[model samples]
Target: MKLTAASIATLPPRKLPYPDSLLPGLALYVGAKRRTWLLRYRSGGGKQVHDKIGYFIPNAPEGSESLGLAAAREKAREILGRVEAGVPVAEAPIHHPKTGGETVEQSLDKYEKYRTRQGGRIKSLPKTMKALRSALADYATLPVANFTRRDLRRAAEVIADRGSVHAASAFLRYAGPWLKWLVERELIETNFARDVSKPAAVKKRKRVLSDEEIRLVWTAAGSMEGVRRDAAKNYGRAVQLLMLTGQRLDEVISLKYGDILDGKWRLKGEHNKSGRDHVVTFSKTALKIIGTGEADQRVFPGVHGKISGFSRLKKDLDKLSATSGWRLHDLRRTLFTRLVEDLDFPEEIAHAVCNHKQQGLSAVYNQASRERQKAKAWEAWDDRLRVILATEKVVTLAKPLTGLN
Candidate 1:
């Protein structure tokens, strides 16, 4: 029988003999207190299922009423429409597993955060990310699995053509691991980075500063002017600190006032490039250069973080010193060279000052720390720098062994 308001009310609590003819699968479900409409049908998968449409009543009172025969038929028709379209229309929406969905940009962002959680230094990763994004701009929206070996080779070639073999190599170093991580998670079948060209060859830089260059840089640092004078001053001091301590640029810039204690700068393991704690004795001049800052605050504060505006400051330093073809890292090499050659400091003591890791059996057996010896060496280095700053005449020194010979 066709379902109608009059027919549905008189229907006893007994089970329906058959479904209504008006709507094929629509039926009035009689219960102890209330009546309800249930639509039963097979889905596209050929499995039978039932869905509750709405409550029914003999007489609808005022604004709220029972689900009438017309309403039940309409709702059933809508659900059947969804089923015919290959959707599983049930009481609740079905959730399916995501497949090949994440884009390259999305994966890269997630990988960056993962590295941070794993205690990896993210200082230089952004450059690599930016380069990759620019090179793979066409593939930003493509799924991570869609990236191919050809993509990696093309990106490396693009970066290398810009005249930085080191940056090209750095791109592979940063991107390769993240792609491998995706493979480990089963997001992709394989790492295309493995099939790409290996990191480009890099010529080790040997651009030590001469005494005349140091003197010129020291004077130039003090004489910075114009709108960016304050930024230049901070970068200049950081450069000088790199010269005095031979520490990594990031470690020196990230120094807090609390790191200074008992005439030593205590560098935490997480902040050091070697992933080990380091303590360096500061000279009187070094202390003066550091000056005073809030105990919990950065020793060299910048607009974004500690000590920025590096490229501009470096250009100015180069112009004033009449120098070319030197980077900030050369300052560290200059200090290590000066300690071993000019000051007659032992090679082992110099390595300790630079926090270089030992090799072979020496790494495990040699626990001998020459803190006092390293302190004296720093004092001697400070004395030498002061003498260079005091005079325009270039101080000549005996050529140091490059170890290449």
Candidate 2:
């Protein structure tokens, strides 16, 4: 029977075949629920093959036809034309032409484009790709298919030899997934970086700044001069917020004015590192440091994007404070440590303060979120910061952190 929109819509669900009268080889296979349009054709060698044209979806919104009768017949004609032209049938269903002589740079570009199309938008993808290209500069122009285990190992070795084990590790982390992506797409035969041993573990940083050092850095954050003064002050405020909240530097810097609402900094799961919602209560000290900005403006605007140029600001901070070898991340650890050692927060409360996920048994059984306790803890921490900042010692409930003028 010749199919129409009404006939296709009224077709009952069954494992039945509907042959198109207009196109000899085009047919629809109606399985339990889905009906897929397929082109039944023969290769030059006369081997019969069935190629999926599209799905026969009924009542699709206008302009989004997957496989209407007219379109399916047109697609079947195109497939048959290609078959008649001696185009070999693809061995794999999801076949893409192999880039046998394609360079690493080209492969990276294709990889990025593929990922973006697949909705895998990673913020660090560009920087990571650039770093990997730098590490493999000697072989970047070489064909991706020609890379072996030795080439990947050599890349790691060269990065390690430059006195950055972390960089070497990061190179492997970026390369492994990228090479695997190529392998999955049949651009390369093997993912050589997959089995390569990771570089030796570097010593973990334990350089927590002392209270005096913290005070020095805090004060120095304001005294920066020339064109960098504003940027420095911005970094200093970010540092203060990090210390007060025990959140990551990126989280603080990426904070939009909208994130501060209802007397708390609210981060949805997508914005948080833990992939869970996080709410940080504001304190008087935090409010003072956040200051006033437009509702759409960033709390700390520095450089091109959210509060960059930390390394340059850190140099000035280091020089003025006469403190060395401290990282911004260490401030998170410092807050956790002080919360326990100085403020007498319980171990679990300290962990909660840092937003670390509770592990094992506690995570499953403990349903209470301790929101009130957290508020009290932040209040205590803010009071301590006021003492350090030499502001009024009283800790009060904070209004909206952004008094945007």
Candidate 3:
């Protein structure tokens, strides 16, 4: 039904929005204490946007702030015209109440508070906010309203140059939503970061460590010493555990004595990337390295919570090991590759041992735990690693063991 003044007056407060018959995108949001006018439309990038037009006042005099039904339709049309002309609703010359010229840094603080109020369930929120502040440090004092697309692009470029394309991409990925949040609150005129082009994709890394490199790393990790000797040794042990178990870096470091039972490391859903409980059988060597501990005790505690000073420790490891161009994650890829190629283990079993989620139809129907197969594969890989370490002479292969093409 077309919204008339009388009809709107009779309309009760509803949880769902009420659409206007005359205007396609115009709607009325009836709340218990107030009513609002909203204009819903799609952006040029196919993103759906609900632009708040204004509040509704039943019997306000002419030139009042609150818009009536007829006035709201007119306002919606005006906004729609600008939007259709390639201007974002945020960028349109609409008068919104100022947020007292909040600076980017202040806005960031507010955003953090907002996320905290929402329960802060996102594990990476803190890191993401830190990166944003670091990337946009130059604009910290600048008002959020003045932050532009060019500025956001420049920030991304700076991050890419200083770090990696991946880092820049991550910054943009977080910034876009944050800018949109500012726009939603009428604090900014536009979500300038939304349309900024991401840095060109970098080649995916496939670096897998060779047997000789693995031996070097193991030896170097064991020999690490400095002022923080105990912490360094703990980090080294954690690195070795990564090689042995093929688990993610975060999951391995987060290991507690309670997580290990009966020669198996049981990872809770929260700790696992797949958000499901996973069990990985431990080799005798891995168990020995883990040693004994109370159920509540951390196996490898660092100065704070878990291992820290990764960059310095990794640099030392690289120098001592005399190996370059490989990451800790490479150890996982190396294990999976060796299991499948050298031992002729089934890909499915290898995947299970790695705790990789299945793909396609297999993910939908294949609920088999494959625990027995995973255990067998783990034992075989453990034996292979022992052999690789025991050999005194490094067998020079005809081809380099960099990665599979």
Candidate 4:
């Protein structure tokens, strides 16, 4: 009358759509479509009538029918058997709030916490959560498991309507991972979202500006409106470094006075993305931009309000670009390309300034802590930058082309 693991394994295939499990009087069924696996368990408190245990699946190759029916009855038995044996599953692993009702907001909150635990980038987390929040507004009332591609597409449409294929794409990307996780944990069947396409380009268009544009922007900065002032200043510097030194935006912004030593900018343990010390050589321009002998909390602290204000910088830059016809990110792109193509900086050195790990031995085997030579490279870049900046001028719409010419 009691079930044994061997007994369950030995049972005959009941029909075309077979019940894979047998607990004496109980039955566990795998679907004919092979869509789902179900385990029928007899209630400890009740009669011969059976109740469903749960689901599980072996990970299968993508796009295979195996994944569709991946959750098998025996796997459910292991989990239920463990719980039944008085091994308490963690009080709340992932989403565990027992609720008469659940909302998308609640699930997303749980997911955000899980992501933080996984060491997902904190700066990116807020942006990711903001997108999820926007997506959930129209769909929050619906069950997360019940969400369909149409629903996802509708969310995508809304993002696209906001003129952002990128945000729409990112939402779908993050959503799929969370949905797949739910599938893996037996919180759901195969993730319906496993097939959704977000379609972002593998390589982003570098948005850094050309030497000419840099000159145009610098000339444009002084005469720009109040809102554009901060943006032009921060981005001007950021763009300069991005082109000149190849430092990431954050690395450039996170610089503290103490971090600079011997005319070099040193990234401390707190700020380096690589989680290692990074030394940025003081190119004459980098030094001139950052090296006011007077100590302050930050070099670009000239922006109004908000200490270490990146958003303010972005806001101002956006305002200026709307009028002047340029975007701040373009500056970084222009810089990366110039370093790679024009200045003859090695690909690895260019990537190093961005704090991107150099690939292959440059990234993995070499474990190089390139300090001295990198400094020289940036300094050389600075020397060239002065020549470029000195040559061109940014002109405003109010003034004719002849003014700059």
lDDT to native, each model: 0.73, 0.72, 0.78, 0.55
Locate the minimum summed-lDDT window of 10 residues in model 2.
396-405
Tens digit of per-residue lDDT, candidate 3, span 291-372: 9899988898887778777887787777767787898888889989999999999888878878886678987788877777
Give the per-residue lDDT digits (tens) of candidate 1, residues 1-405: 556657887777766633678778877787666577888889777888877777665533212224567777888899889888977564664222122478778888888778777875565666667766766665566566656566677667777888877777777777778888899978877877767765566888988988877876666655554343355567767777888888878778888888888678986656656545678999998898898777797876665576666786677666765666888888888898999999999898888888887788977787766788989989999999888877857633222112110
Candidate 4 per-residue lDDT, tens place, 272-325, comes to 556556777777766666756445566644355222444554445434443444
Instruction: Looking at model 1, report the run of 10 residues with the lowest lDDT sum.
Output: 396-405
Q: Which residue pairs in candidate 3 have backbone atoms (N, alpha carbon, C) closer than 3 angstroms, thus clashing?
A: none
Best by lDDT: 3
lDDT of 4 at 157: 65
Arranged by TM-score with the best first, the candidates are 1, 3, 2, 4
| Candidate 1 accuracy as TM-score | 0.67
Pairs of residues clashing in candidate 2: none
Off by over 4 Å in 2: 1-99, 117-121, 226-229, 357-370, 388-405
TM-score of each: 0.67, 0.65, 0.66, 0.60
